[model samples]
Target: MAVATAALGLAAVLPGPASADPGSEVRISRTAYGVPHILARDFDGLGRGYGYAFAQDNVCELADQVVTQRGERSRWFGPDGNDGEGVNLASDAYYTGQRRAGTVERLLAREAPLGPTPELRRMVQGYADGYNRYLRETGVAHLPDPRCKGKPWARPITALDLWSVIHDVNRVSGTRQLVPEIGDARPPGTDTATSVSRVPGPARSADFGSNGWALGRDATRGGNAMVLANPHLPWADGALRFYQVHLTIPGTLDVSGAGLYGTPLVLIGHNKDVAWTHTASDAEHGSMYALELAAGDPTSYVVDGRTERMGRRTVPVTVRGADGRLTTVERTLYTSRFGPVLSTGWTTKTAYTYRDANADNLRSMNTWLAMGRASNLDELRTAQDTSQGNPWTYTLAADTSGDTYFTDASAVPHLTDAQLERCTLPGGPAEPDALDGSTSACAWGSDPDALVPGLYGPSHQPELTRADYVANSNNGPRYTNRDAPLTGFPGTYDTGDRLGLRAELGLRMIAERRDGSDGLGAPGFTAGTLRATMFGNRVLSAETGRDDLVALCRAHPVLEATDGRATDVRRACAVLARWDTRADTDSRGAALWGTYYDHLMESRSPDETGQGRALADAVRDFAAEGLPVDTKLGTLQKWAGVPLPGCDGGKGCFNVLEASPESGTGTPTAGAFGSSFLMAVELTPDGPRARTLLTYGQSANPASPHYADQTRLFSRKRWVTERFTAAEIAADPHLEVKTLRG
Candidate 1:
């Protein structure tokens, strides 16, 4: 007992909330599930409400966020936190190494305050103060540091951290725009061109995709319109949505649903008269800058025609242990207008400039929060108008009008080709660079609201033309296209494999339900899951996957299509498809295809298909593994739990990404993150009745019964009831209660 106390007590001596202050007073009401019904008066109050709620469910993660956003990781991570010189922290190194840190930093330094009115700025700052107060008032001494040890204190919070987080949140307001650097490329005649119509750069790839839609009067049981939320994210922090809440400030606000950590408001979900869900969108919302070095060496560049020496800023990074002495490893950094120039000790010393709509996107969130309380399209559009951060947005909204509208959103930058050519720094250019921020109109000034061609008025945002509307895995800002695709690489657009298999099957199911009719109601909405499953099956049915892949079923005729046993089969099938029509993984046929792609990189000119390349790599890697491919999706795909490991236990168990196990790369055989937080909502005469199902439910803490308790319902594609009314919450049996005040 003495030894344990001594060890635990030392944590108290560590640094904690240095700027702790009393935060905004928040009132909380709890139902049976330990979920809170919070009421806050205004924005700051809401921030307090959120910070308190997040702290309750995930104090450790919340604290880590504060430290990370503030860039004060080393204080908590110790000497080994940053690179050798001791600067950043674990998340900082990994996040930045992935080439996004400078993106966040530059956005803040150069762009965050772009539209902040003094009032808005103060409100944001107040929210930060309130958050810090929560940390103080709670007297939270030590927080769990899961990434690295020796750091126990909660660190600190600041007003700018709030700004920084919101900036990042809204910057990624659009789905695909979130990581433009990594998305599936559009072939010349795809749908994206009419959307973004502006920013498109070197690297374009898509990791995976999702499917979701709304059913009107025609397909429901109760004759009410229904909206389905089936978002697919790699089960990880900021990847999946968490912390569901029902918030009401009455006249000021009354909304319900979920939001991810780090973000202040709900990124996606529903309110009273509507439900909004997002899949990836095919929009070119990100831009890369061409950076030039300062007046040094032969590569010296000229900025503003002034010989001002380029500023060399070095950023240090950290590695786990140093020489077994329990320390860190660090590196230096340099930056330019195009942003930081980075290297991973590889041959590619690539110089790139990247920008997103996320930097000053606080308004994007402001509008979302406002929509929670809005009752009509006018009010919703009002919110949409103020969504300053979302540059290329694909927004779909359903109103009481029985009308659905989808608008290609964002303040599209209008940079001229001339500007793109001249604004570039000293680097490479015979014809000049793709875009130089200063010279290119694409990179700068103009009414961002003006560039979107069709975004002018009513028809610009089209909704469910028929009473039954659908938005499957297209991730596109387009209404269903009837005409054939046009040919051309029009600037500011993404044109590729825009439509996926989901759209094919979703439209089929909708047609069957309505009998080619309109008016979809509640009954049709309730059968959403059935529709999804049927569509998935029907589409894959036509494209006879691969003969060799299907034949593997002969080996295990009566396959147990449950959990990992079945999941392995799918992985095997996915592998076989990559086999170049051969049954064997290591067949000469497979190598033929492999060598083809390899030679293309060396032999071909500019390789345009980032999507094709990524997908090809994934396939080829699986083929090299020498494994039999199976043909059942469910047979080899199952949700595996992502377990948080203890300090002394084996390395932590975490999310199961969709990757080929045979590749022996990416995640292990685990697949914990499947469909989480599935909700089917319908607007009825009585109001809104929602069926919500969560896989690995509400609590991130594994110890809670809520953890994985919802797993069964998730697999069945069923749902547990969710009621915003006080009376309903009172009825839940497992209701746990906690009082939160700050």
Candidate 2:
């Protein structure tokens, strides 16, 4: 996606900046977790350090992405193949389209007036180079392909390879750009509905969402700014690029945060002066305009007020053939103004108009890089005004001023609710049938309001409660309790369930102030407050008397439990009490139950159930059916699908979140996906730094000795500090060093 020149020739992709000196070096050390504490002399060196370190374990993923960028997936895996080959095929198609995408590329190329600064770009490139160096060092030898069953590796990677990888990253970033083509399988009674509401789907779709929050003392009265980032994502298929690093540019900046592969800087976390976070807007940023196919044929459609050819794009995907060699697959891509029109709808004569923030060419990363250097409130807002990245969400930042601002900064096409409704399959009265998968379907309403999606009408900006503090990663500003109801823009849009828990309880904690003061009525209530306020409500519900388990527990006060397990009795109870027993976290009960509304302290109604389902309920159910109140967590809660849960053929338990563990009664738990990556910051007159919680240990390699090693600490709410200073990084005896030349 990185254009090479005015001619718009796509740059041949490259690896991390190649080392100018063959002897130039970088070093990495393993800390408490497998998280690498990298040390390098220059920005490029640092990148190489991280790259080599990451590649040691996840080279396969890295290489796959590299293939994806060049649209070479089909070449390696073969075309028409759905498994490994399909991805390559798809990637190839997208890349091929990009090569043909003059207009699209031009639009994507628009610099967001600003983006990552030159210095930060160097840093990003530095990391990429570091990764390439790893390829050079280790990929020189053939490695086993667990998926393909071959010695898959690199003889030597070039910068072109890295560029190819970025090419894939760009494609992944725009996966939502294509629209599904509606075909002849139209179902009955489908047109009467108003707006798109779970019309029959094509089966499954992508799973991705994130949660981030910033809490201040007015909210916590704690002397620091706390940022929690939980990006909920499916684990496999190159879905996440998680890296936790503490970047110290000396006086320029200092921050402890999480980064993705390919990205140079942290996505969310706290710097010296402030902390910022984000969450998806869940707005129908992408809409579909029904196509009136010529003579009811599914393939032909109208564009620009005239019947036009729907450019046919065929993707050849490679997969493992029954005979073993990779095979080819050919898939079709048709276009409308929105982008590529897909075939998804059943028998409905329509094509969708694809749109999303991905279309925004503004410097999303550049804006963030500037964000890292922002010192005060005004500068922060200015940095944000660029509206570079994902437009369908908002980013919130808070500084020492106890000041916070929320902005929907993205170049969004102006499409009204009326316009959006028209596009819905079950669209309302005014459903407009403009079938071309192009921009004409959903026209930009305006630019001023387009770039900024959220409403800043009258009232007050969502701030750290004067009496409290609040922040979110696309978790809306509903948590900051102003006098108004939790209605900022006035509609229910849930990007993910975690945001629900965060917003609902975040407000409750802020509003539950016993004192007339603006903040929570406690002296130093951060650590315990989190345990009591957030974790407490979900685990310990007021519900009672549904079964005799409560009465039995009343008889036995303490349950002998192991420490450190988030699912242990104490931990389990705390988490359970705060969460509503509902699967849809956006439900009012989700907020109320977690908030301990009128009934949090009160006993449960006879018919009401407790917070968690499986272990707590199962054990309590057993007790009600003649078991002891003193049941053990290990004995009841078990790894349901662990393939093999028993060590010596005995059962052990595992916790589920976001969604339920079992098939029936699919209610989710807060423990599911709340805090995958959490870091707490302390930036006072004393300056800034952080403490972190990364759930599974850092490295992706399961075989490495350091793998999963940090899980023990993270599970216990413990953190290992990041040593950013050169001296500190070098001082560790665990250091392993290597060098690479460009």
Candidate 3:
């Protein structure tokens, strides 16, 4: 492991914020659940404390992200290591290709207001230094966590490494998933072109999900603004996992909530005057370009009848083999004027390429910083409009002045509907997603209001401000509020009127709670009611489908599965008949419903042909696992020995918990991804009051006391009372303090 260059010493210091140079000193105060409250003089110092505390709980994951962004995964882990979507060799090639092309460096070199600001650059530098300082102090071999302790991959990182990872995260929904197709793309006669594993279509909406609601005075019980941020993300230890923190720079900036590991900003949090959260948006941030090849020349594409040779580059990636020997492999990767060439089953006559709007985007940190410092909804809107840095998420925010805001201000292409229609290739393989590359005019449209030329201006995108509320459950920006639907936006912005079941459920919950008709004793939402609404575990599908299912079960007591198995489902039917539809931990029949739904969907038949049989098979599968059909949801859906409540959002549960199936059975064994960092913030007379929870807990290390503490709380439908005020933080019984100096 390489020795860290930064020198930081940890010792006991005074409790107040520092006024010295940012790199000189900072203080980190840890409250219950290991949530860090960092105090510093400025942005750099805030990042320093943030980086140190983050490293204390998640050094291994941080190191892993740095390695991944540096295109060194194959070099350290292996060439065959799977990066969830593709093989490590391919992932390395894609990242290395971008590096060799000097893509990130060029973006970074851009002057401020478009690229990273000086403050953001300082924050990033301090974050890297603080991460390296922790490494230097702990000595990589003696690191506390066993995952990367004494591992060769646990090397200190630089600010550039952090920037690279930021670039990768900003493209989560874009070309990041096309690594295999990009890396394996070769000319028709090349040996690698035919073997490219075809990535199915555009990225699935399931890749990211969340429910964000900003409730204004009209909808809140106390006539104040309230916000509920429930992001559904993978629970695995990686870049997607959220880390809770409270960053303060005295009067300059103070915000609390959670950000993905390795980020320097409080991505979803609130200060005294404003609170904001994000939901995954389905707007197109990247687009496919179907290239027409020149006659008899696969490497040359025809643009408006002119032959243009594809730009070629050779990327060499280092791979560590089974014998611990390092070898370099060189791959010739091709690119077009649009972007990287992709091998999505392209023929000799035509090929595909993709352009990601966020490939060189480096403004998210600045945008988030501006939001944190914003005093009201107007300022927050200004932040989004000016920075244009939100990669692919809708921002939902509230202010003390009783205003609510929602916008899908993601970095979408500025292409107009007419251009999309005209540029769409006839019989294109990835239609609606792919455009004709034969004409240069089919390229991205320009908007004067856009910070970048190829993106839609803020005015052209959809946004809404309503006094009642604005809510999004991974839906388009049209129906943020039922009464005040935002329309007249370009089709590229996902202005569809139809809503998914999960999104429908989100709106229903907000409306029900607002009208006080959902039976929780509320005409308007309070912080407590907001919490209840989140974990109510209402299974919308069961509520809408269960009675009919019960009638069907009674009609067919005996059913035969397509697999030739038969079962008497009368007992299961009886249990479900009297069962509640909620997916609470103790709710019986929820597990049965989950399995039934999975099997029923897998059968692909909506009628009684395989539907009844699917139910029978679900029962049989449960019994085979020695579990009853009426087993509790928590009993089946668990992780790290903690019983997680809630069924899959696909099954229409507002409190989403998507789980994976047991081996060879439809029965769900453990949660896969959904409902990660959750927070309910209310702006009151005395600043903002909030309750938050990181469902998977703070530290990924099993030995850490905080590893499963919050997960247990989440299982019990509990939340950690957010200690935002200085006095509140000092009053915590489990509070621990540490100060670092350089």
Residue runs of model 3 more than 4 Å from their true location after superposition: 1-23, 83-86, 193-195, 204-206, 426-433, 563-566, 624-626, 664-671
Q: What TM-score, computed on C-alpha atoms, does each candidate reach? A: 0.66, 0.68, 0.94
lDDT of 3: 0.84
lDDT of 2 by residue, 227-306 (tens): 54555443333535566765543345555577655555666766668777655444334434555554445566665556
Q: lDDT per prediction?
A: 0.44, 0.44, 0.84
What TM-score would candidate 1 get against the native?
Answer: 0.66
Global lDDT of model 2: 0.44
TM-score-wise, the better of 1 and 2 is: 2
lDDT of 1 by residue, 317-349 (tens): 443344433344343334345443222111112
RMSD of 3: 4.4
lDDT of 3 by residue, 2-84 (tens): 21212221212244354354346788989999999998766787778888898999899999987877788889988777544
